[model samples]
Target chain A: MVRMTSFIAGLSLLAVLLATGTPVQAQQYPPVGGRQFPLNQMSPPGTAAQWAINAGRVAPNYLQPVRVTLPQDGKVTFYESLERPVELAAPAQAALLVGRMYRLKVTGMEDFPGVEFFPSIELIDRLHPPQGREEDFPIDFEFTTEEFEWAANGRLITKVIYLEQPDRVPTELLERTPRITTIEPSRNVLAEADDLGRPMAIVRLGGRTPDPHRPEPSFFGPGGPIRLPAKVTQASAQQRPDAVNSR
Target chain B: MKYYFLALGTVVVVCVGCAMDGNQHLNKGEYHAPPAAMMGRPGPMVDGPGPGVLPMMGGMGGPGMGAPMGPGGMPFGAPPQRPAAPSTTQIRFVGPDGMQIGWLIPNGYAENQLVAPARYNFFQGGTYRLKINNIPGRDSLTLYPTLQVYPGHPNTEAYLTHNSVPLQLTEEDIEQVESNNFVTKVIYLPDARYQELAIANVETLVSTRLDPGVDPIQEADKRGTIMAVLRMGNMDLEMPGQTGKPMAGTEQGGIDQVAYSVDGAQNQFMPPLPIGPAGQGTPGIPGAMMVAGSGMPGAPISGVNMAAWGMPITGTPIGLNGPPHLPLGGPATLQSHTVRNRSKNEIPAGVKDMLIDVKHDPGYRLPPPVSYIQYTEKHPVYSPGELSMPAWAQGQQGQGQYCPPQQQQ
Candidate 1:
């Protein structure tokens, strides 16, 4: 009788296990059109969507979904994959003018799975002179698309579009400041950066950029202030951070 | 008792089914979301065209629809799609008898990863050669077909050569091209994490005073011009051992150089570029820059000169006879090492004041003061394979230098 009872109890346990199925949660979102990205593990679909929105590639004003082809130099990479750097297309490069905004359609992404493509817009106004490192700009917002379609070749095509915005460039970006020049007596300056971030003036004293491997010139060392050109007074200049701010 | 046995059997059967389901999930390995959660089109029109408004993709050049065509049309929103970006395709150069000669990744593909089937990103509609495998000694000489990916080529497949022609390169030509005439692609990451690591590595390599060897992965030639430096996947970090298996072969530690195989087909139609020393021209023997140690005047190694001889030039050595071999004075290396180091260090009080002084001072044209100096050594007079000197003439190669007796003190 005990054995019968044990068997009955085991049967009940088996029924419960089968009813619950596996412990793994079922996938919440089924892939569009029943096809998932081949290398989906590397880049989540939602992340790609966000990149599209931020880049202004997917926007509301998009009349129709226009596919923006990645140019020869443009790079498409996955999240956290820092080793990859891609170039921009000439047309894409041109569209990045300051005060001008654009909306692009995300397409052809289905072909390259596990890769996320982000367009890097120059932070400085396109019309302004290029700044080496200080041209501070932020990336566009991330977005998602409403449509999904497959090309004739069975590649999934993204149908997201970014909206365009009015040009809101700062006046300072368009207005150029006159270069400055200052001359003083005690310590002379060779070059300087004006308050407006332009090169104020450069006094070429015939000194080459300082080399650190060799011993410091007798006048300048770890002991004191750097040697300045003689017969010069209080000078104000900005040097490209050759030592600390550059690679 | 009979009921107990039956129950246990039933439980075992259910457990087995559950295990199978678990295995299925693992095998699929893809994260999926339901269709309802996706970003569907917005309800109200926010800007430009209204929501669900589809413009004519056809012939009409409507005002807001088609926009302009030539150059500046469609400044924003729904610009015409250009050709797709070309992608890197994994290819194995198969010999006539089907032997695996070498693996080829496009110029920008991640090279450090172990050989696997992957589609790398490249420029669309660009033409390039599939040569220049990065093996230490065995540079495949057999010519492969030049690949020109079509503008709309699908990125889903690997690049395969349907037709290939072999060229008869004189051993000297091979030597020249291998040393100097090849193209270089740099791997760069804009992320701060990578930047920190790169800065740290550069600092450690520079400040340690213990002459660290060139980075095995990303190498910057003495010109400060960087070629490919692949550091991405674990597969790239750990190369398969000599037996052609990871960690299983006799040769286990140290660097595992890539292998190359040259078999059939060389494209004779396309002329090789002139990459040898300038003035010497194409196919000409490169002018060798020989440095004799103070003690060992005659014995010098051919290609090993780059790492061994230490001159104060600011770039890494690019081997003998390689292109970009800066003749005694090529301009300073492109990177500013001092600036990189400065960015890593905290500003001292006096230095901060000096910066303010410069910013305020008008005539400071020479830029900021550099903290240190970097120098690249000269190349050897002869190419490695082209070296005709006697064995004793070969100087010691690699990181350790062949210092002159006088300089040794």
Candidate 2:
């Protein structure tokens, strides 16, 4: 009863039937190219946390993981859930803060110098509640010549910017400077290499400093530089009509 | 609880160690570290050797404070843990000129409450002074200058003092105080941070003197000022939109019309010294020159014939008032218009300062600048009758029922 669209946008609105999971929606926007940030997803433990409702088909919990093919090659595991709601700072503008959370997963792919996707990240849509613009939000991860390569797999090449959303657009996010924080093998790696032979899969970013956290989409209009208005926070995702069958 | 007391004991030891090593030097940085107001000490009397409890003298001949006085009335020694100059707490005020006037100190509020006498009116405004007093939560604040102009007559002899300067003429005297009566206010900060000694560090000792190693936290030190700006005026008097929240519900007190520059500038007036000998007194006449002269007003002659002090004085006392309400000379409704169409036009320096008489609108008038407003807050209160319902409710008056009118009836 539902449809799932890939990373490519349809020239005209087309609907396809899905096996079960994915919701049937209109045309989906392509993912924005993104880079890895060094920020941890959790709070300081004892503090109260704001949570996000599960609306997407994939669940990025300890039990299950989603796999997606990268533009370069090799497989990346997406923990389609994990990240909860948080109030992050919208860069540049000293006033506004973020209302949504990144739907993240520490993937099992040599994330660097490769196209690793940051999926399910929902930007508080001005009109729609909980529904996300499709493919998943993408992050362009690059590697310098000095960085070591995975002897088995070829090096990765990233599309740093989304060709569609330039600096002039309202929802177009800003470019993040290429600076790597930390990268290492995932705890549960399918294959492990010691002689610096295999590419390390999965890297976590964002520690004490800034730099890596996703930069806000810059709005240049009217009075010099204007930032996007606060995302009208919606309570919960709409319940799927065929809830029992969605699983 | 036992650990807490032990920690207190350790604090005692470190305090002793610190006393031996703490520097007493006051002028090391910006603030006046040494406490003034002379205090007393249990010392040997000036003329006593016989066993008479040893008569003592004061620190100005009264209570000795944390730092002792050195040669030529300066505080001696340096504090052991004076923070770097930049990290020190700074006391700032907005002068009549609207510029930030600041004096950085290596300390915080003396105790949470800052009380001091003004040698003069406060030149600076805004957050007046940061204090480091001993009070908690509500202390560590400044006593703001009560901006009042002298209301009484100048002819009274009781007005002058032994020093001859008006008593209110403390260091930061405001020129406006020459015109009003008394101005007063009290503002307290609900959150003020301070150093608290741990209960355990009561007895530990390092080198027999007060030591940080003994009580670590308790033995630790911090500094603050005893002075504060207690009075709070219109918070947004300087910045726009600052008064919105406070101005919404409760009506504010009236403030006289003293229009500052609309484009964000302030007016300032320096003082003519108090009427005394060094000021206007004459030589041969004993006190005549100093007392009779106008703070030597016209002494420094200028090229301008305008009273030598750059003030407007006419043949028949111009620019001053006759009695109350009757504005002197004209209604100030006069305006001048100069037609210019060019962009980035030159004002031609002094030509702009020159007054060019213009025709008035006659019936047209403008109102004074600043106005008063009301404010409200969410004051939580409880009601007894409503036991079954959720007690915490919101209301404008802070009390009453939340149920529908029909249901209550």
Best by DockQ: 1
What tens-digit string does per-residue lDDT give for candidate 1 at B44-78?
Answer: 11112223322211111112222332332223444
lDDT of model 2 at residue A31?
12
Q: Pick the candidate with the highest lDDT.
A: 1
Candidate 2 lDDT, B2-119, residue by residue in tens: 5444444555545554453322332222111110001111121112122322111100111112234444322334211110111011121222221222221222111211122112
Q: Model 1: how far is A187 from its true place, Å?
A: 57
Candidates' C-alpha lDDT: 0.26, 0.22
In order of listing, the candidates' clash counts read: 96, 124
lDDT per residue (tens digit) for residues A120-141 in model 2:
2212111111123211232233
Worst 10 residues of 2 chain B by lDDT: B155-164
Displacement of residue B45 (Cα, Å) in model 2 is 50
Candidate 2 residue B341 Cα shift, in angstroms, is 99
